[model samples]
Target chain A: MRRIFTVWTLLSVLVCASQAQSTGSSDSETIKELMQEIKELKTRVAVLEARQGQPAPEQAAAKPAEPVQETPSAEGQTLSPERISGIFPGIRMAGFGALSYKANDARPPEAGLLGFRSGNNDFAIGDVDLFLTSHLTSKASVLSEVVFSENSEKEFELDVERLLLKYDFNDYLKLSFGRYHTATSYYNSVFHHGQWLQTAADRPLVVEFSDHGGLLPSQGVGVSITGKIPSGSLGLNYIFEYGSSDIHRPNILDPNADEIVENNGHATTIGLFARPDWLQGLEVGGSFYHDRINPDGGPFHLGQSIGSAHVVYLTPRFEFLNEGFIIQHIIEETGQKLNTPAFYSLISEKLGAKWRPYFRYQYVNAPLQSPVFSDVQLRHGPSIGVRYDYNDYIAFKTQYDRTFRRQLPDINNLLLQLAFRF
Target chain B: MRRNWKSIIVFVALLSLGAGCVISAQSKEEDVAVIVNPQNSLESISSAELRKIFAGEKLSWNSNTPIFMVVRAPQAHERDILLSRVLKMTESEYKQYWVKKVYSGDVPREPLALLSNGMQLEAVRAEKGGIALISLADVRQGVKVLKVDGKQPGTAGYPLK
Candidate 1:
C-alpha cells in the first residue's frame, strides 16, 4: 500500500508538471513546491509514528484496505484524493464479517437441526468498494465507486454512483446532468452501500429491499437540480431520469426456452426528493420513484411506483435513521394489484475510533393480493452488528439477525465479513 | 448532617467539571478567513459572490484571468469550518456540490490541501485566486484576507470571525 501511494504520488506530480507546462504559468513551480512539502510531510509523519510507537508502514500495509487514488489535474491546479482519512477527498476501505452459534435440536425431526442457534458460523466479504472523486475544473469533476461482491463472485461492477455535470446558477441553485444515484433515502444518499462503512451490518429493510432485489437505484442517467431555499432553512433537490434501468437477471430459468425474454430490455424511472439541513447533522427528506418496464410478454409487466420518506439524524458519535416505503405494482392487462408497505429503523453508536456497534429493526408487510403471488405475509426482524474501521479503507464486521414471523420458528443467522475497496 | 456535606462537595465538583468542559471546547474552536492573492484587488465581496467563487461559479481572478480556487481536503478542520461559515453548508452538501461540478466538466480540480498549517500558507501564496481558511493566529504575508461582508476579522461588523 505504501509503495502504491508513493508511485501514485510520483505519477500525480508528473501529470501536474505536464499540465503546468501547457497552461504556461507558475503552476509547475507550485507543483514542485507542493511535492517538496509532501516529502516533508512524510518525514514528519514518520517521526510522529515513531514517537507514538505505532506499527510500521510495512505492517500496516499487510491489511486488506481500500486503495486511495489521488489524481492531479493536467493543469496542476487541483489535487483530489479518493477518500479522505481525516479530511474530505481522502480515500479509505473498510471490511465487515460475522459468526454465530445456533441450537440444532429444537426443530422437528423433518427440519434441520439448527434451532435457536447460539453459535453458527458464516463469513463473507460484505462490501468491497473503491471511491474515486476529483475536482477537475472549478465547475466540474467526477465521483465514481467500484463495488466488488464476494457473495456472488460476479467480479467488479462499476457503479458510476455519481457522475454529474453541474452549473451553479447561483449559490442558491445548481443544475446537474449525467448518471447519478438518486437522493431517495437519507442513508441512501450518503454512502449507502456496505463498503461505505456504515455502523450496521444490515440496513433497515424498508430502505434495503424497496427495489427489486436488494439494490436501490444506485445509478441512473438523468438531470437533477439542487439549491437551497433563499433565506429559508429548507434545502430542495429534485432529479428527473430517462434511460435504461439498472435491473438485471443474474440467470435465466431456461436458456433454451422457445420464448425467452432478453434481460436487456428498456426501462425508465423518475425520482423527486427534498431535504432540509438547517438543523446541523439532521436531515429530513422524501422521494418518489416511478418505474416503467416494457417486456416482450414476460412473466412480470415491470411497472411499479414506489414512494418513500426518511428522516436521519447524524451526530459525531451517534445516528438515528428511519425510512418508510410504499410500493405498488400494476399488471399490464389483468389489472392485478401488488401493494407493499414497509418501515425500518437503525440506531448506531460510534464506540471509538475503530469500533461502532449498531442495532437495526425492520418491518415489511407484503400483501398477497397480487396476481404475481399466491401467498402474502409480513416479515420483520431485529439485527445487531458491529463495525471495526481499521482506517478509511479497511474494516471488519460481524452481525446476528433474529427474525420473528407468524407460524414459523424464529429464524436466526450470523455473518462475518471482510470488506475492502480499491 | 455528614451526608449533606458530602452531597455539597459532589455538587461543587460536578459544576466545576461542567465549567471546565465549556471553556475547553470554546478554546478548541478556531476562527478562519477566506484569502486571495495580494495582487488582485476586489473590494468588499457579497455572500453571493463568495458562494459563486467557492462553488466555482466565477472562475477567474479580478484580472479576468481564469480563477483557480484552492480547496482543503474534505476532512480538514479548516475546510469544514469554511463550508459551514462561508457556504453555510454541511459536509455532505459540500461534497454533493463538488461531485456535481466534476460531472459537468466545468471544474477539473479537487481541493488542494497541505498536511500542516505551514504548508497551507505556502500553497496559497504560490497560487493565484487561491482562497483558503486558516487560523486567525496563523495569518501572514503573501496572501491578503478578503472581507466577507465589508468588515475585517477584528471588526465588530465582521460577518465571519
Candidate 2:
C-alpha cells in the first residue's frame, strides 16, 4: 500500500510537470506568432510609407512647395470619401447650399424686404456657395468664394463674393489683399454666407448686405491687416482695413466692364476685440468705420461713420450673441447729421447632440428722410427657430418671424430650410 | 480515492495557469506617446501648446516648418484620449470644429487621418514636419517622442495615459 501510494504521487508529479511544459511551449509559440506578425506589419508599413512619400503624378508636376494633401489607406481597395482628397492635392474645397420653403401673410410692395418675397408662399432656392482655398507656399495662400442664386426673374446669377490673397508673417500680423467682407461687424466677419454655420435661418435685418437693399457696405476692395496684440491672457486682437467702400456703387464692381471704374472714395475701419483665456468662448469687441458716400443724382457727398459693438459667448452647447450699431450720416454741405441705431440679441441652447432651439430679437430704426436707407423704416421683430442636425454635415431648420413696421401692418412669416455643407 | 486526489491536483494546476494567462491578457490603461519627426528640435510641449497644435490654431513650428499633423481616424482609442484630454471636445464637436475652421479659411487643410499605429509611425518617419500620437508599445526608431508637461510616458504622474 505504501508503494502504491508512492507510485500515485510520482504519477501525479509527472502529470503536473508535463502540463507545465506544454503550457510554456504554447505561450512561446504565441509569442513567436506575435513577433512574426509584428515583423510583417513593419514591412508592410515601410512599403506603404514609401508609397505615400512619393507624390502623385499630377502633384509632381505641380509646385514643389505644396505639401501632400492626404494618402489613402493601403487596405482600402476602393476610393472612399476620405480618399477623394488625394485628387485635389493641396487645394481644399468646401461648400454650403440651402433650400427653403416660405409662407408669409399679405404685405404691400413698398413694405417688402429685398431678399424676402411679400404676400406669396413659394419654394425658393437659396445661395449655392462654393469656397475654395489653396496654399501657394508655407506663408502665402489664396481663397475664393463664388455664390449662385436665383433672381426675381428666376434666372441664375453668378457672383464672386470674395477673392483674397493672404500672407502671414507671424501670429501677430497677417496681410490680405483683394475683395473681402468688410470687418465692420462681427456677423459679417464670422458668419459670412454660410447659412448652415449660423444658428438663425437668415441674417438680421440690421446687418444685411448693401446689395440686398440693406444699409451697410458689406463688401470692400483693398488691403486688410489683422493680428494678435500679445496681451498675456486677455487675448486681444485687431483688424485694420483700408478699402474701396461699396456704399454707393453696386457690390459687384462689373468684372466684365469695358473700363475699370475706380471707387469714388476710400473706407477705413479699425476694430479691436478680446477673447480672454480665463473665460473660454467669451468675445467682446468694438469697431468703427469711416467712409464718404456720394449718392447718385445728389450734388453733395455724405460723411458716414459706423460705430459697432458686440459681446458674444459661444460653446458647443450654448451661444449668446449681442451686437449694436449706430450709423451716422452727415450732409457735408449743411453739416446736418442723422443717427440710426440698430441692435440684435440672439441666444440658443442645444438640447442634445442633434437639436438646438434659438431666439433672436432685432431692432432697426432709420428716419424716413434718411438719405442712405430711405426705404428702411422702423423695423423691430423677434425670430424663434429650432435647428435639427441630421448629421454633422446637414441641418434642418424651422423658423418663425414676426416683423412690425412703422406705418405698415405687422407680418408673420414661417420658413422651413434644409442647409448642408460638403 | 487516490485517483480522485491526483485528478484534483492536476486540474488545480491547470486552472491556476489559465487564470494567470487571462489576467495577463486583460486590457489596461496604457500610456500614449506624442511622436514627431526625428529632425524636429522640440523636446517638450505644454498642455496649452498641445491643445493649440492639435486644434489647428498653430500652423508652423518654431523652425518655420509648416506643421503636418496626423491623427488616428474616428472610433480609435488614441483619438478618444486626444479628444477628451487635449481638445476637451467630443468626437462630433471636433469634426464640426475642423469643418468650420477649414471652411472659414483659418487653416489651409485639416490634419491627415490615418488607420493604424504602424501607419502613423511610418508617416511621421516620412515627413519632416509630421507629428502624431501612438501607444508606447508601438513606438519604434526613427521617430522622436515628445514629453508632455515635462514628463515622459510610463513615469509616475504622467499626464497622458
Candidate 3:
C-alpha cells in the first residue's frame, strides 16, 4: 500500500508540474499579446494627440489620403477617442479622377462626334469626383457627391451630382430624399461617375447619363425607398423612386448650371432584384420608369415609359453583365408612338491579380422620327478593353471601340486612360 | 515485488493517458469568436447571416440599429479565418470589395479596422451595433460571444477557427 501511495504521489507531482509549465507558458503568451495590444493603443493615442495638437511641419507637405478613417459624431462634434468609438462614424470621403487620350476616325457629318474639343485625337481630363457621407444619427445619414468635370470647351466645371438625406427605419424600410442616381437599371445605381470604380474606362453607351447623349434619365431629384424583402435565402430587395426626369435635358450644353434641373415633368421608377444565397455575386433584377416627356424641341408633352432588365454576375475574378431596355413614347396630341430598344452585354476576367481584359457589345435602335432619341438612331458595335491595376488605388486601361451607325461609316476609336482613387 | 510491478504498470498507463490528453489539447486549433456588444440582444447568428453582415450586405440589425463592423488589420490570424471562412475572400479581394462598395455610395464607409484585439474589444463594447472577431483564447468579459451556426466556440461543428 505504501508503494502504491508513493507511485500515485509521484504521478500527481509529474502531472502538476506539467500543468504548471503549460499554465506559465500560456500566461507568458497572454502577457506578450497584452503588451502588443497596449503598444498599438499607445500608438493610436499618439496619432490622435498629434491631430489635436499643432500640425507638425512634416505633415504640411504631403499628407497621405487615408482610406475612410473613423471620425467623431455626425454633427462635427468632437469627443474623446474613447467616447467616440461607440457613438458615431462621422464623415467619410473618397475621391476619384481619371485622365484619358482618345483617337477616333470620323466622317464629315460625324466630325467631333466623340465630343473632343481638341480635334478627334487629343488628351482629355475626366471627372474629378468626390463622394462624402456623414452619419448624422444612429439611423440617419447624408451623402453628397460633387464632380469637377471637363467641358467641351476644355474647361473644368463644378457640379453637384447627388445630395441625399437618408433615414433607415429597419431592414425593410429605408428612405432617402434629394438628388440621387435613378435606379432605373442596375449599372446606373452601382457605378457612378468614378472611373476608377468601374472595370471599363467608360460606362456602356446605353446606360450613360442623358447629359452624355445616352438614352436614359439617369438622375433625378426626389425620394427613393429601398429595402430588403424577406424571402429566406432568395435574398430579394426592392427600390421605388419618384422625381423629376432629365430625359431631354443634357447638362453638356450648360456647364455652369449647378442647380438641379426641375424638368416640367415627374418620373416614377420601381425595381426588384434578387441575390440568391446559393450562387453568390449574382444579381437579377428589372425596373420600370414612367414619366411625361417635355422635349426641348418637339411637343409640349409626351407619355414615356422605360422598361429595363439586367442579369449580372460579379466576383473578384470574373464579371458578366447583360442588360436590355425599351423606351416607348406616345405623342398625346397626335396619337403618334415610337418604341426604341437598347441592349448591352459585357464580360471580363481578372487574370492573376492585376490584369483584367474585357469585351462589350451594345446596340441601340431608335427610329429617326422618335422625338426623344432621334439623335441616337441605330448605333451598335463592340468595345474590347484591358485594364491593368498598378495598385489598389490606380489603374491603366486601353480600349478599342468599333461603332456602326445608321447611314454612316463605321467609326473606330481607341482610348487610353489612367484612373485613380484616393 | 509483483505488487510493485503492478503499481508501476498502472502509473505508466495513467501517465501515458495524461500525456496524450495534453498533446491533444496542444494540437487542437484555437477558435475565432464572433463577438458583439453586450447590449446587443442577438444570441445566435447563422453562418449565412454572419457572411452577409461581414460582406456589408446587411447594414442594420433587426432593431433598426445600424451595424458597425470592426475587423482586425491585415496579417492577423483571426482576420485570416474571417476572410476565408466568413467572407470567402482574400485580403486583397476584401479591400477591393470595400473600395467598390464605398465608391458606389452604397454604404458610408468600410468596416472599422483595428490593429489589436484589445482595441477591437473596446470598439465593439462601446458601440451598440458593433461586431468583431477575436481569438477565443483572448476573449475577456464585457462582450457577448455569438454562436455561429448554433455552435459556440470550443464546441463541435463550430464554423470559425
Taken over the whole model, the C-alpha lDDT of each candidate is 0.52, 0.75, 0.78
Off by over 4 Å in 3: A1-90, A109-115, A247-264, A297-300, B1-28
TM-score to native of every candidate shown: 0.59, 0.79, 0.81
Which of the numbered candidates is closest to the native, going by highest DockQ? Answer: 3
Where is model 2 more than 4 Å wrong at Cα? Answer: A1-90, A109-116, A248-264, B1-28, B126-128
lDDT per residue for candidate 1 within A17-64, as digits (tens), equals 768757764767788778766755663443343324433345333322
Candidate with best lDDT: 3
Query: In candidate 2 chain A, where is summed lDDT lowest over 10 consecutive residues?
Result: A253-262
Rate residue A301 of model 2 by lDDT: 77
Rank by TM-score (best first) = 3, 2, 1
Ranking by lDDT: 3, 2, 1
Candidate number that wins on DockQ, 2 or 3:
3
> Relative to the true interface, what fraction of contacts does candidate 3 keep?
0.36
Q: Please give, for residues A328-407, the per-residue lDDT of candidate 3 as tens digits.
A: 88888888888999999999999988999999999999988875565668888999999999988899999999989889
Q: Could you tell me which residue pairs clash in candidate 3?
A: none
